[model samples]
Target: MKSTPLACAFAALFFPVIASAEAEPSGVRTNTARLMTTDAAEVIDAPVLGLQRTAIPLFAGLAVDTSLYADALLAPNLGLRWALAAGPHRVVLGARYTHFVGASTYSGIVESEAPAIQSFEPELSGPSFYGVYGLVLGPIQLQGEARYGHYTTDYLSFTGGAGFNFAGHWSVVAEAGVRVEGGSAFRAAAGIRYGGEGLGFGLGAAYVDLSDPALPGESLPVLPVLDLSWTFR
Candidate 1:
């Protein structure tokens, strides 16, 4: 199963100025900044930023954004976002729809087994809705989110993330989440990130909670992530 913070992302992008103009909630470069994959109640004001985001902040709690890469020629995508709260803490709701041509390559990948082809992969592509919350303190931000969709086996998911801003435009962040469908899966990641008006980036590692490697002497798998972006904020 998969989840997207389409609504929470909007609140994070457009609502930050509501609490205080000085409160740019993005301490890191991952769109909302509180988490790597999770999003906060802030906005991506610049033209382009982390992963693949091009956002246009329209007003106090409204913005327009596009997924530069994910909405590809083969995969059409669209969504809507609305921030429900205007205070220091953030609340938001949103929806997204995507049609992937060859989603099974990644979305349906399963554990390798003796039969070489254990099960047929399903094309999990459709509309998804989500809600997200953000809590911001002096220099720490926490976020929680939930999403539901029929994208894959009538899926549902919950994810949370935390970020600590230590210095100017520098912070540490971590996130963990679970997805439920025909089965349940857990994923987590932690790392440091930097968010600047003109440039931002992140360096971290991620691990998926799954079966261990089959071969002897083989350890668990850990994937490193390095995300970078530039913006004209």
Candidate 2:
């Protein structure tokens, strides 16, 4: 199937997950008491991926030098995120689209040799899928998530993170895990979160490295990312 169509389908799947997570926020529907978000307003993470900057496709098998903007290496590229609480349990769902525009250029040119600049632009787009299930215990919260995508050459990843809600409306979260398919590797991230009433937001970065030594000159090891979103209740 075309990448665009497949992304649409994947994006559609997140809605229900958001609904259920929003309905209850604490424990297994049957076990443990429910935990819920203290605020009712929707939250959006302006910086996604925490501190990481770039993610390369392991399956591509080729090295290409591309500018960050030309690469469209960012998320919430255009996305909608939603979350809900039930007592102390919570569910969060996010959907995002990432796009890359490719171009070519010639640095120097002589009068008779060749044109000064030449380039081509190709459309690159993919879908970002996110789901999180968590249980709140006192001042601490534990959450596990599964993420997959077709936005950057079909990849799958999983992560687990913990959050601490301190005095006032401030919280800190840290996560670590592995991403597979194309080029499998381990990634870690952490960031601060803030929210109140009907609004929430996060800022952070992430790091990713594929285990294969043969692919040494792959892409950059550090990927810097930014995420932003708005929720409607």
Q: Over all chains combined, what TM-score does candidate 1 have?
A: 0.68
Per-residue lDDT tens digits for candidate 1, residues 1-233, read 54469977878877866768565544433543335555555554545544544455566556555554566535666666666445458786777787877545543454343234445454646888888888777678788889888765687888888888888788898888888763347878898887777777778887754353333343454677666777765
- Minimum summed lDDT over a 10-residue window in model 1 is located at 106-115
Model 2 residue 186 distance off true place after TM-score fit, in angstroms: 0.5
- TM-score, every prediction: 0.68, 0.49
Top model by TM-score, which number? Answer: 1
Q: Give the whole-model CA lDDT for all candidates, comma-separated.
A: 0.65, 0.48
Error of 1 at 124 (Å): 2.7
Clashes of each: 5, 39
**TM-score of model 2 relative to the true fold?**
0.49
Report the C-alpha lDDT of model 2 over 75-182, residue by residue, as the tens digit.
224444556667776776655666543322212222123343242233347776677777777657787777777853687887777766664556676777777765
